[model samples]
Target: MKQDVQPLIVNVKRYTLVRNLVFGWLTVVLFAGFLLNFPKINILEHTARNLYFHVPMWFTMMAAAFVSGYHSLKVLQTGDPLRDIRALQAARIGTFFGILGLSTGIVWSRFTWYVGTDVWWNFDPRQIMVSIQLLIYGGYFVLRSAFDEPNRRAKISAVFNLFAMTALPFLLYVIPRQMESLHPGAEGNPAFSQITHPVMRLVFYPAIIGFIGLFWVLYTQRVRVAWLKYRVTQDSEM
Candidate 1:
């Protein structure tokens, strides 16, 4: 019992350190995001501010998916129930970021490109592919609930989580770029760096790091809580 409790103690200490650091870092990013000056392009003008907020959401989602995939791989190797918990938490958080990314993109696009029109969604390739990606992860959560046995659920869900991770990059980046898209890096559109001002990159990079750190903090908290519940109930679903 002491051995088990000891690991939890160490985890708590580490989590506390990271949580505080991420909070401070993100606070700074938020301030810089709004306060810093950016070059105004036609159409994008003020909405260019979204580069710091919107782009980071997808970056955070990618980071979360990577973390989830690593844990899922561990689950396959060690059959550790805790790995399943981590995978689930990471995927859930990743999905949250995906949703934010989609929402922000819609708002940004509506005002910038569809100002005179009533279009909220134009069925852009990136938008369609990302929506499908989110649905794939949605299936992962739903699949977990179908099994009553803990080990079986963990094993099966871990497999599905891996598949979801595999599909992420292609759906979010590759396929979207292959067809016509208003988004940067897509067919005929300039890549991000080509259109974005150098000054914006300063905030953009840190914003990515800050959002990913935020994801880690949230994911770790959920894992700790779920672990506690699992220990007490001997059930991995919390």
Candidate 2:
């Protein structure tokens, strides 16, 4: 007789520690984002404070993207349903954060980069490329839904997930830098570091850490729920 191995959803004590720490850290980050004084820049003014929220979201999304990709790779190698669950949930949450980043970036740009103009959708390279990258992730989800069988679905979606993950860096960084864009580090624009003040960096760096921590907490919870659902249904769609 063959022995069945159980999946570890999460380590309860460690998960609790991480979840609480992320919540506390994010509370500080959000509070300090608005309360602390930021150096006002030309056309940015107080909106510069959005740096703590907006930029960190992209970092979180990027972290989630690579995480999703890594799990998807494992799914292909081991054919584990748990890895599939993680890959799907990570991409879903990552896409959610990516949308938030894009939306926040749009709001930030309107006030600073495109002041007094009615052009809200001017096809900025950074914006368009990010949108395309998100759509590719969208395709990954839809591809999962197309297959009724769990094993087949997991395998096929893992392949698609890998592709989506592989494309993320190019879409977010490489291609955007090559074109003229409203965002930093594009077409002769100054680098973010050179332009940023040290005082602002204090919060900026921590904000990235906090948001990435938040992503993990959320992803872990979702994985746990998916594990439960899989126990009941033997399917990992949720």
Per-residue error for 23 in candidate 2, Å, reads: 0.9
lDDT of 2 by residue, 35-65 (tens): 8886668878888888899999899999999
Roughly what TM-score does model 2 have, to 2 decimal places? 0.95
Q: lDDT tens digits, residues 70-189, model 1? A: 999999999988898899999999999999999999999999999999899999999999999999999999999999998889898999999999999999999999899999999999
Q: Judge candidate 1 against the unseen true structure and give its global Cα lDDT, from 0 to 1.
A: 0.91
Model 2, residue pairs in steric clash: none
The lDDT of each candidate is: 0.91, 0.90
Model 1, poorest ten-residue lDDT window? 1-10
TM-score of each: 0.96, 0.95
Shift in Å, residue 194, candidate 2: 0.8
